[model samples]
Target: MIDLPIDLLITNKNKDKTVDLILSFLSKENYPAIQKITDSLMYEASGRAFIKIQTGCNKFCSYCLIPYLRGRSQSVPVSQVVRQIKTAQKQSVKEVVLTGIDISQYQDGKAILTDLLKQVLTETSVERIRLGSVYPEVFTKDFLDLYSQNVVSNVKNGRLCRHFHISLQSACDQTLKRMNRHYTIKQFKKTVAQVKKAIPGVSITTDVIVGFPGETDQDFMESLQNIQEIGFSKIHVFPYSNRPGTLAGQKEKKWGEVFKKTKLARAKKLRDLSKQLEENFRKQFINQTLGVLIEAKNKQGEWVGWSDNYIKFQISNPNLKRNQIFKICLS
Candidate 1:
């Protein structure tokens, strides 16, 4: 019922500094402006879409580009977002991820995240709905309670798999402070524990940066200890990529080269640990069947998919098509 032009932003080309000035203040919430641009582009391509409801972050994680690139926190109205979801459904998007620069930061005064979820799932026609990143601080009791139950409370082949990608950048409290990460290890641990206890069998993943401007050996050890304690299914480790306009960059410019080298080394170490973590996590899947959504066609005519819990699955049968739901028995 809403008229808007959804445009795709181009991220290619050879150092096109001329266009950089224009992109600095682009707001994703301006849907009519977006649709104007997308309406033209869709004439050539099929529409597989993204609904980014939350816009920006207030937690200025030192090594991140989200706050500056996306700006401060703004959430799309539930009515408007549901309208977009209905539109995407008409176009045959089998699943949709509710994304944002910082979805956790979205709170329209009394209208909170749980309210938005109730509105979306209850009213909309999205076949499958997935959430974007959620912050550690706001992983409240209400979120866990509503999302805990699978469609039929069927433990084995459950529905409505609500996963969380929590940000626990460094398990070490000291390193977290140096990186200007707001939450502490104890607080983060307690929050995570409570969430897991609330939502059993929920897939939890995280992000960790091994080396920062002021991380020490003891700090790295502490991080590893916490990672071991959490037993996270997966982790994306970035060796602290520094960007300008952040406080850390300003303070550590003189030690840039040295810091970068240390970061590289620490990154390698963390990566090794991450692989071990994955292998350990995989052991839990030794004899389990998972509901997977096939999303890719691999070489040799195989179909690949991701489980609702976010595990990768591969099948060699060419008969299966992309975006089809399948039950995968993992080894």
Candidate 2:
């Protein structure tokens, strides 16, 4: 652990040091530490645990400051990740979420994200392994095939969770190019189609940014139409706001910033679509049995938790214990 633990509080530059500081507190000398613990430090007395498997982003998308603020992508060793998950399992943790700033870029020597996942699955006995936001470029045939065989087929036993949160900022090719996105909309569509075909009843979610600088009316419409066509289970919508020192921020004056009112209006349109899409995705699972990990009882005296596909739900079963998985049927 580093000597100056207080540095974590002052600035964002010391992202790597913060990991060391967390390990110093959580682990004794005999125990090991993951270089990266899911994106942030999130631990609860419930069944699920979050571990940052990687940190930082190499994809300096024009609008984002994550690369400048957090530095380049760095992955935790596979052995360390497995060790941490095993320790959590010993503490009765039933679910482990592998998270990061950009886990899709995770690399430790020759091991990539898929390799790390395989190691975790083979070495640990965590009931569920959920993933954080994965960049679209990582979804190669090899990766999808591995997921189909190992994660989708083994859903009955609750291994890897059957949910994908893809980081797709825009659907219009021109807007995406301006935003410096690595993959085209067509590539993303193909990947999603492949995953959907491989895993039945899978939940796919995504993020979208509306009203980016210089985004035309046609561009906005394209995003809306394409997103609806893709049919994501849910979407997290964001209005474009300039981040200081980023490429988009510098080009704001030249590109002409999107009007505040226009941004809000566009955001509303996307959000409305999100609601419809979410309802449509959830409709298929109605009355179907799902594996749910009971995390806690809410203030309403009902057990609240998430289904294996990442749906938040509540049940009124008094016999259910905290930190346990149960087969629950949706009504």
Candidate 3:
């Protein structure tokens, strides 16, 4: 244990002062990202394991600690990933999600996501694959070329045609600059435009940080407007946390206390907007039959899983086993 301090402020859904439990966001815990993917695949998985090919980021965005915490851009090697996918086939797992702290940046020589995709689809027995998250800058022409023409054309099997999370932190150029994000709003828009043109019904999701110390109302409004315009399938919104050893953490000593009340209010608002966006996004997929890998069965007796496009499916199949893949009709 790193021995987390007991004084950490724990809160509640109501935003009121609360009790303890450092129960991390399961998605970003201290656990190895690879293990997380594997566990999700083995237990929570409906049918396939998530293969984490890379760890860490060299980008070092001002607000992120991934470079410090997860370490630099080292890959798990393509051969290893291929081996794991083969094991997945023996387990009868039908899908594989390519995950990484920086999935788009995974590279070793001429091979990148394009090369990885070609291998997984053409060589592997996994029937479907979905990306974890990718930086927009990494969504190169090779990616667009495949994602566009393929209305499932280039896919050999188990590779998604129109899905990716493009980490759009903010819609305002100024906000993006302050956040140390590499791409501008214009660049992001241009990239997304090409993706949309290439793949109809592409699900582009993003992350937006609200209440950065210097963000003005205009900046906030601009981010919201951009979210609406992008028509994101899901928006993972977070209130900026001033973690130690980072630039934002360094500023915490100088800048006055961030209004916890206000920032949470903003997060809540954005979450509401996110749900609305997801609802609208889901409407397009009503009656859609998507390849689903059953992850876990809830206590409510509903077995749920995510489609290749990451659309959640709540199938009411009680006898279904976890880590099994099936094509389920999306309502």
Report the number of the highest-TM-score candidate.
2
lDDT by residue (216-319, candidate 3, tens digit) is: 67778888887788788889998888877888678754543457787788788889999999999888888877766688878888988876666888878777
Candidate 1, residues 39-135, lDDT tens digits: the string is 1101101123567677767888777767777667877777777777777777766666777777887766677787787777777755566677788
Poorest lDDT segment (10 consecutive residues) of candidate 3: 11-20
- List the candidate 3 regions with Cα displacement exceeding 4 Å: 1-45, 148-158, 252-257, 317-324
All candidates' lDDT scores?
0.68, 0.82, 0.71
What's the TM-score of each model vs. the native? 0.81, 0.87, 0.80
Candidate that scores best on lDDT: 2
| lDDT score for residue 173 of model 1 | 80
lDDT value, candidate 2, whole model: 0.82
Cα shift from native, residue 223, model 3 (Å): 0.9
Model 1's alpha-carbon lDDT is: 0.68
Q: In model 1, how large is the Cα lDDT of residue 179?
A: 73
- Answer with 1 or 3, whichever has the higher lDDT: 3
